[model samples]
Target: MIAPLVSVVVPHYEAPHDLALLLTALELQTHPLDRLEVLVADDGSRDAPEPGPRPYAVRVLRQADEGFRAAAARNLGAASARGEVLCFLDADTVPEPGYVAAVVRAVTAGADLVVGRRRHADLSATAPDALRRWFGGQGPVPREFDEPTWLREAYERTADLADAGDDAYRFVISAVLSTTRRLFEDVGGFEEAFSAYGGEDWEFAHRCWLRGAEFRHVPDAVAWHDGPDFAGRTDDAQARRSRNVEGLTLARFVPGHANRGDQLVWSHPDVVVRLDDTGAAVADVVASVRSVLTGSDAGVWLRDGAALAVLEDPRVHRGEPPASVLGRARYRVDLERPVVLTGATLADLAEVAPVRVGEHLAVRRTRDLHRGGPDPAVLQVPGVTAEPAQDVDLQRRWGHEDHQRRPRFQRSLRTPFVATERPTAAP
Candidate 1:
């Protein structure tokens, strides 16, 4: 196979010393210099980053200084990259000579997203020439720092993410992440609304998984972070507050168990419900939506004129779900008739969908549905039907007169929502 061109994008921000060392390390990569390029995506530093002279092509792209915009900076670099594979690194992260090759090999071998092993070390005293000798095994190794036990244990338990599940996204670290350009575009790159320091990588990884991207942890592709892991940092009131904000920001986009709470309605729901108007009564549609919302963090989209009363609830929307919602949602339910199922049952059904429940209700894994592949499994559940015609007993049947009443939904309305499109390349 022909070697794919790899664009190494380093997000930098007022870290010229770190950027210089990173560039020097890139110069010694085992990957062919002719097939590699480096793009320094500067996040509005006071002085422009100078990559200096290099054997390979190196370009610098700068975005206005506007707080922490690493996500946007990465996206800008990726958008302009002219490579088939894109590798992301932080300005402070320096890779081993074989890092680029190992990462690219995995992507070329069919991993949609690859996360390299990020080790920590005190590189503050290290210089460009010292880094070269270190790679050459001729100099004293830098003092190593403690790796986050949580991350190390996670990788060990997941067998390098070979047995990764839906929540495996938490293991991806942008400082040592790589993917094909096609997969990156398919997942809409990193979310640019992340003006904070963290959570962008996790959010991007979550969307990639939801888009059916295969994930791999490449331990051989190693890089050294400039300092210890965040977990190893000294805890303070300011650090605690920052971490709290990061957790909350991540919770809005990733509906995973660790980051989310039971009562909050996040921007991206775990399930998207599309209830078609089967000429059912307004009460019936409302009941169906309520049933779905009862057990899952779900957003329901009703066909036009289905029911305006339910719209009062923030979770209910008119018309089909937008591309952004569908892209991030794990499951999608289509109902031609009103049906009720507990949240646990709904989750179980999604795992084995496309399932028909009494001919009018269907549950599907949104990723599988988007892929347009043969259904993994077809199932049928008996006895699920539309609501009864008796309108007076609707409240009694649902056990609540205010089923449509709930707390307001809160979410960031970031612009340029990603369009739902099938991945152009196979994972």
Candidate 2:
């Protein structure tokens, strides 16, 4: 088919160096410049960038300062876009030359949505920068290809594809997502409720799911992203994210990611609280399979001891332990926690932190704790009905390398690939 009109939508803020890299990459695209429309929405820059109208035919849309947000800007850009497909990018990301062309190729091949492969960027040696990188995988550019191409492209003709069942979330990340403009509007676009950052893509993806749009992972369409941004993650950011998280609870646990008792619930055995004065005490566990996480179960468990302390807190649930939380309590486990809970072997131990049900450890599995269903909790617990069992080695090596071996992706992601080749495109 004739090349579909394509528009690249960008929301840039503080990091100009990364913006420069993204611009440079796009400038080298093999696709014809005339068919491409690059619209950048400056989401309230602290200071306007000096580069004025120059060689390339890019349109810069400016707005008042509104706290480095991109969702509103995206809505505005999409409203005015003429391209058949709209692609979004962040400031600190660089797309390869063939990225756009690859996106179009995927769309024409019958995929409703296409996502760009993302690789972690390299970091400067400054101490602060290094710490930031470690927490968010914000280091130097990754040496490996962001993703493989064929895996992304073959999803088209879904029947031929071996298992579209696994890769069937029809929504891609706005960082480099493309779908027909028509479909985007039909779904009412992204929810402006998700202001500054975090989970907007997921919200929009869920919206698309509600509207019946299909998405695929396009690996060849690669870009380098500046790790995940926790810069704006203050109390307000978290509150907003939590609000969205709550609203999307049903969407999250059902359908695509149906409840599968993730790590948060399944790995309860790894965490135990012993409040005995001297082998003559009671216990309270901070984690549970499905009940609300009010400090009740744990509080009840803690009241029975002379001194209650935390045991295994690989991931801190709430900020620091509250001083007024019943008795004088302190953290127990040291170092980091393992990542045994979020794997595919979904487990459900009634209550991860077992409750004293009668004389026996009366435990009840969560409502949606099985695999192949909508899962509520982030960590996938193994859906075994048996009582929770502890792994001694897990307890021993709690923080030994911890989750360092796993790639630092806070969320799940798929790699996707391209359709046509343009001579001007660079690697």
Candidate 3:
């Protein structure tokens, strides 16, 4: 198979010394040199970054000097990228010779999102040539030192994140990551709103999660960050305050466990399933809501205002359309008809929810509801099981059977909206 071109986007501020070291390391990558394209995304530095002499292709992209805008800078790099896969790296992080190859292997194996292992070292005293030698294995492996133990444990426990939940994004880091340019642009690129030092990566990861992008941890693909981790950077009061603000901003934007502490104030709902009475008994609706609520902490949006007064449940939200209530939820389940849900349904949803992209998980559908008619599904109770509904038309889609289906579906989970056509390539 022909290897896909890999665009390595390096986010550089004013660190010319560190940037040069990183670029030198890139020149030694085990991946085919012809397939590698290096882009130095300069964040409005006073002096432009020079990638130094290189046999392979290298480009420098610069934007106006803005306060910490790594998110925007990375977005710019992605927009300029012509490769099928985009690999992101910080200016100070230098990768081992095999890093690029490992990233390519992961993507070719069906991983849309991949994070390489990042190890930390105090390269402040180390010479640039020595650093290059260490990365090339010509010198000692720069003193295998302390790294994020928690992060290492997470990948091991999750089996390289195959079993990770929607919340697993917390473990992903932008220091070393790779994904298809198509998927990156499809998810609306990184939110440029983040102008601070942190949280942009997590926010982007959360968005990718919503779109069903697969996450894989490539531990063998080592990249040595030039300095200590963020925690070791500074412990002053101002740094603490800035970190707190970044955390809160991330909570407000990213839903689910990531934003669990700010749930009441946050607009996004974690799990949303709409319930319309149609012709089903109010008792049936209540029972359905109960089953769902019991299974998970999903917010139930009631279509029948009259039923809202009767249910009197705190979890039941009724002020607006289900989509609006969901805000930016990654996925929303629509109950076309009222049917008693089993614990197994909730269990199945939890498992299938993370990997579902461009498709909805279907449980059974009624012929009447399939035709955009009212709920004709009969609820089964006690020992008897309800016969599965057979609606051949339902096979075509997952949501409202009556509503005209769109040619394209938006990755947005909140505020149910569909794009007429998939967004054009990232600009």
Candidate 4:
């Protein structure tokens, strides 16, 4: 079968250090340089755009200062392309060396649109890696390519188009995605009408799926994303998020969610914290956020997973898995014997005792970071881990690695803190 020419199109705006990393990776793709073209679309940055040259043979193009966002930039690159597959990548992401060949394989093996995985590359902000712990959240998003056997098969078996909105949380980021030129034009090209802060990809993909394009995750094709630098602050950007929520987009795309409260903590951009847990108390918290999350689009217990789907937040939805152990939806505290999950590291502990969790004065009571999600059950009982030695194995993600026989954590359980002790309290 004749292979299709692939275009590795990148959209850059005042970000070269990150862009260079992306280009460097493109240079290493297993696919021959002859079969691939790397093009950079300079979105009219204030400084002069890099006139990319040899080594990578990258084509550099520019557009007027219309502020159309990465979407517009990709459109411009596609307009000048000679490839059949348009591999759209954000400027800050570095594709894995095998990316091109993987895309080619998946597409030829039959996926019309293949989405790759994104791992967090750098923490450009102070304590970014730390703060990520404080909130019990992950970073750089967890792009659902986590386990792709299902993703690959789904795409190949049916030509039916898939969309992020269909799974909203997992389909989260538009970070590393590949699609055909046909899928591009039929979607009407990123809705130039949806100005600013970029939800255009989701909106555009929604349209394409509506038009008959298939989407899936390509596990082996990966990218390293320099996670968003929110500058240690949340501001007007929160307001701008409404721009994407304005049109009937939410009405049609998001089910079970309502307008956010006048202002809600943890309701930051690109990241979402949707509460799909309809358990008794879970529904109460859902009512609390009644202002923001609404609709028939909500996931039911039997349909959605067991407890809280962290993938709900647009940020987390797009695979920005919480950064530190504290950030992980699955409990990522980094060290042992202490409660500061954020500052903890590989040398530190991933879980702590109930007393340690409660002893921390910052918390007043226990509440799951997942809100209407699963409960971590932190409580101030000393016997669970010692004296009254109740044995609970620290759960580990299924890995191909063997187990080392050292108690991951050993301490007297004392105070009650977040994620400790599920309530048997009457609803």
Candidate 5:
């Protein structure tokens, strides 16, 4: 098969020596040089990089020195990239000859996001010539640094992310990441709001997962980071501060349990609840919104103007959720009428969603709703039931002892959605 053109984006600062070593490594890649292009995304280096002669096309894209804008620099490179797939590498990271080929293989094999294995080494004494000779089997291998135990264990536990779950985003490191140009644009690139070092990769990966992007770990696609991991280099106090900032920044975009605190209002909510005016009492609508908010880190949208006016909380929206909210939200609950549910019941329902109770529907996984392929598993909860708004007593129901009873429902049902496909460049 003809190889798809791949653009390697190297986010750089002022590490000219390391950049040259990386470029040398890229030149040695087993992938066809004609099908590969390199873009050095300089995040406002002191002296702009002037790379010497190279076989493949090489370009340098620079931005103003506005703190650590690696995220913005990467987006700039991606915007200028014309290749079918985009691979991200740090300036200090040197890829093995097979790195590009292995990463591209994963993408072409149907993985939307692929993270190459990032090994570490002390390359301070190494030069570009030595690096090239090492690839030619003429020099000794560089002394290696220990890999992060946590990361190695994570890959092992998840079987190289083949059985990844919701929290798998934590393992996606940007230094050695690759994805198709289509998926990169689909996820809106990385979060440029991140002006610091970390958190951007996690936020980007989380968004990718929310959009149903498949992730894979390419262990054979190896790269050597110039030094030890950040945790090993920094002092405890400095590390703590960085971690705190990263956690806070991540909480704004990633509503996952690890990043979010109990009370903070995040930019994206975990779940979104939408309620249309079913002509039930205003009290019933209010009760419905309350239940969802109490159940999860959720934002409610009320179609009724009266309900919106009365609901004073910022989490309550006046109409349908904006594209930003809908795009990031993990689950969406559509209520035909006001339904009363306890926090425990609402939590349980979200786990096995695409469930229907009368006119109410809850999409447990919003990506499945958008993917529009085979029907998603829609299992019913044992004690959950939605009764008509008018027939149910919204106020008194909460006080009833039997309200907590396990619900018994019928077999699962399938909901079909229209499949949408984006046009791809012909090979």
Candidate 6:
């Protein structure tokens, strides 16, 4: 495939020196100059940066000073981007020559969300002579520092996150990440509500996961950050406070995770248990529903008027078949009779739920259903029976004209090969 045009977005505050260095690195990227656009997103700098001569196109977007609004600045840059892909970078991070090219390679290989590796260095004390020497490829620049080991291990163990689960969003860092414009637009831009630092990336990654975007980590797309990792920063107390606030902000959006003192629901119900009138009396259906709701706080979709009358809990949501709730809810349990559920069952089902509805359907039984044969969508769950030792409502059907269709994804690990050779600097 041909290389795509990329718009690199740099979020800056009052760091002109760092911003200039990053822009210099961008000018030397190995990717085709005509295929790249540089966008500098300024977050209310007191003294705005002056435009300077650069090989590639540069556009500076400024927003009013309103606390720390990096999220809003990035959103603004994305709104004005005119490229097929958006590559995000912090103003203080300078990329290697092959950074843009490696990112392009990953995207072409079918990754909708790609995170590049960030190598940190103590550049705060470096003079202009040392910086020029490093950029000029004349001699050794500086000593490389440690990166986040947990994040690196995650990518390697999962082979660039081909088998990542819901929690994998925690490893996605926006400081050096890239994704297609269409995918970014579909998820809606970053949550501008994050006025403080941290956690704008994780929320965006979760939204992309919900939209079925492929996430990959490109280690060869190396970038050099000006300082140590966030944990190693000199200001420890402020960092901890910001992290706490950020975690709470994320708990509000992501399901199954919550901070202490929060009244919000911690474990979200994955499936909406549906009870239909299966030739049973309303009283029997209501009793079955009560049994199902023993420990689970899941909402129930009631089709029978009698069942609806008995259960008055807020969790027992009543809706018609194929309601809007079905679209939002991850799973649907259609049963003839209610089964006694322990606390563990609901929690277990939530973990193993198929990523999307209609992808996989788990049912009580799968053999000999009445009328028009068994629904191909239903997958039988063994050893689970209704209370009072009941008959299978939609059971006894398997492998006649139907067999369980397991899901398969396009999974592969990509190893990026970066060129060490550098082009001579323009005079």
Candidate 3 worst ten-residue window by lDDT: 358-367
Off by over 4 Å in 1: 309-311, 342-356, 370-427
Better of 1 and 2 by lDDT: 1
**What Cα-based lDDT does every candidate model obtain?**
0.82, 0.50, 0.72, 0.50, 0.83, 0.70
Give candidate 6's whole-model lDDT.
Answer: 0.70
lDDT of 3 by residue, 1-427 (tens): 7788999999999898888778888888888888999989999999988777786789999999979999999988988888999999999898889999999999888888999999988776666788777766688665555788889899989999878965677888998988889778867777787888888898888767656678899987889998777877777987889888787778667765546552263455556667665655665666666666664535677676455757777777663443234434654556655545443444345444332211222322211122243322332334323222222223343235336666574566667765488779978
Top-lDDT candidate index: 5
TM-score of each: 0.87, 0.48, 0.69, 0.48, 0.87, 0.71
Worst 10 residues of 1 by lDDT: 383-392
TM value for model 5: 0.87
**TM-score of predicted structure 4:** 0.48
For residues 76-114, write the lDDT of model 4, one tens digit per residue. 888888888889888877776778788888888766677
Off by over 4 Å in 5: 278-280, 343-345, 354-359, 372-383, 391-427
Please tell me which predicted candidate would have the highest TM-score against the true structure.
5
- Candidate 2 residue runs with Cα over 4 Å from true position: 50-56, 123-171, 228-427
> Candidate 2 lDDT, tens digit per residue, 136-203?
45554343333324434555545423245323443245777777787788667765655545556755
lDDT of 6 by residue, 220-283 (tens): 9998899888877748788779789898776655544332242233333434677655556655
The global Cα lDDT (0 to 1) of model 1 is: 0.82
Q: How would you encode candidate 5's per-residue C-alpha lDDT over 64-125 as one tens digit per residue?
A: 99899999999999999989999999999999999999998888788999998999999988
